[model samples]
Target: MTVTLQLEQLSIMPGQRIVLRDVSWQQFEAILTELGDHRASRLAYDNGMLEIRMPLPEHERSKVLLSDFVKNLLEALDIDFEPFGSSTFKRIDMAKGIEPDECFYIQNHAAMIGKRRLDLTIDPPPDLAIEVDLTSKTQLEVYRVLGVPELWRYESGRLRIDVLQSGRYVESPISPTFPDLLLVERFPGFVEMAATAGTRPALKAFRQWVKEQLQL
Candidate 1:
């Protein structure tokens, strides 16, 4: 059976993918707390090998806002990625799959071809999957399950970069996700740069920084 992911009684997307909706906040809290307290890690339910990612509360806002930031950046770079897909599916998927506030494909637009469920034929998990964490769940379990090569989790205004290696994830100071973007010496300030400069300005600044390093 398929489920739709929705917000406030409106369908956000359509597909056979599982989605979480219609559950009361109390019930949602109960489930999240149990998973976090007992598992001490992130958990996603799947009867088959299909991947899933779920987000915690408060993170929803964080991820959405970050999406706006990233979307603007991608546009400035002339990169192409659809902001959203299959709204009707999101409105009703009961399986409770997590949605990345923003998602994009690096290569061809043809990769989006599929029905009901997401087409995973592409490699490296769509270049990046950004998350906003408000709980104890680690990216280790989440990224592994998602089979994504790179993941960026934002927490408390800081970004933690994770790179998938040998079927597991590793935390590193540098990000393998956007190898072109360098964060030398001032890695921590990357988000601040994005925040303060705005998307286009921040991206231009990032490019300038990269050029400076190349010249040096």
Candidate 2:
């Protein structure tokens, strides 16, 4: 039997997160759609376990900056991609559900081009997903089940890229989207600049930096 929190009866504290065990996929979907377009909290479900969290202000800051960094890099490198910010992805048979902070289709962009709707069973999963984890760790295992190809995790002003290999994710020193952009050697400083310079100036600086790097 599936059960959910009786919000009308329960008292939840400010910034309190709620998790439910034995939640069916349908219940999770209903809850996700009910809370449509709300960015105050993030939710994830794996099999029958569901987790909800209210992100901190710093979380949003890092998320925006990190997403800006990727979009800027893609534009500078002229890569084709589609952004799916916080879209819910679930597969009943796979017993997995996720709402990524931000996701994108790059290498498989053409495959998904002009599609009216995305069905993970018939469609490919997003190539990359970004998580600015300030409150808790991401469920990479859930992503692994969903067949996500790559992940970028930022925590405490640092960034790390992980690429799916076989059935496991292996941390990589180079970005899967831009292989030439050395993640360990060159990307860390850029992350710092974004977090410190504020969004607009950091984006401007990043555009300039990418142009310079391309010229070299």
Candidate 3:
């Protein structure tokens, strides 16, 4: 059985160190088994420390903005990646859980067919995971446990990336996962503009940027 206790006193601080406690990997797996697709997050205990995870709330604009940017970039470059569904990440099972803002798939969209529950063990990990952090927390640590290849965290309107290297996460400015793509410095600020531009304007801008990047 899993139990959760909230430590509201620990107000999340920006760039502050987060400590996870009282978690076990086995316990986390059990919780995942129970919740199935309904599960949002899970906790893992490694050595002595605990890790908690929950799903970040749904932000339609952010998802569309980011997804569209990636989709258009890939299409313009003739790279193949079709996004089928996006899910908000959540961690359950341990003493603490964190839910990232959004998660998505690049390939293997066929595996997701007719499925309501996500079996991480069966479902291949996403090609990319995106998190928009309004507050600081240990959400990224889930990537370590899940072995996701690439992670993108957006904060303060800037994007920071983490890619798995030699079985561990390393932050980098360049995206090894999609090396041909170029995201301009002003790209982060594009999200705010997306809100005002509506779908057509945003798509136009994204298409323009993609074409420019591809010299098409």
Per-candidate TM equals 0.51, 0.87, 0.62
Give the Å error, residue 175, model 3: 1.8
Which regions of candidate 1 fall more than 4 Å away from where they truly are?
1-43, 46-58, 84-97, 113-125, 134-142, 183-216
lDDT of 1 by residue, 1-216 (tens): 877543335322221123343455344535454444322123332321222244444445456555655665565556676543111111112222333444555553346544234434332244566665524243235446656566676766677777778988787677653455554234436556656666557556655665565556
Whole-model lDDT for model 3 versus the true structure? 0.57
lDDT string for model 3 (185-209, tens) is 6467567667676766777877776
Ranking by lDDT: 2, 3, 1
lDDT of 2 by residue, 2-83 (tens): 4645634544443567777887888887877777765566777887888877766777676776777888888888899888
Clashing pairs in 2: none
Better of 2 and 3 by TM-score: 2
Shift in Å, residue 39, candidate 3: 11
Model 2, TM vs. native: 0.87
Worst 10 residues of 1 by lDDT: 85-94
Candidate maximizing TM-score: 2
Question: Stretches of candidate 2 above 4 Å error?
Answer: 1-4, 8-16, 114-116, 134-138
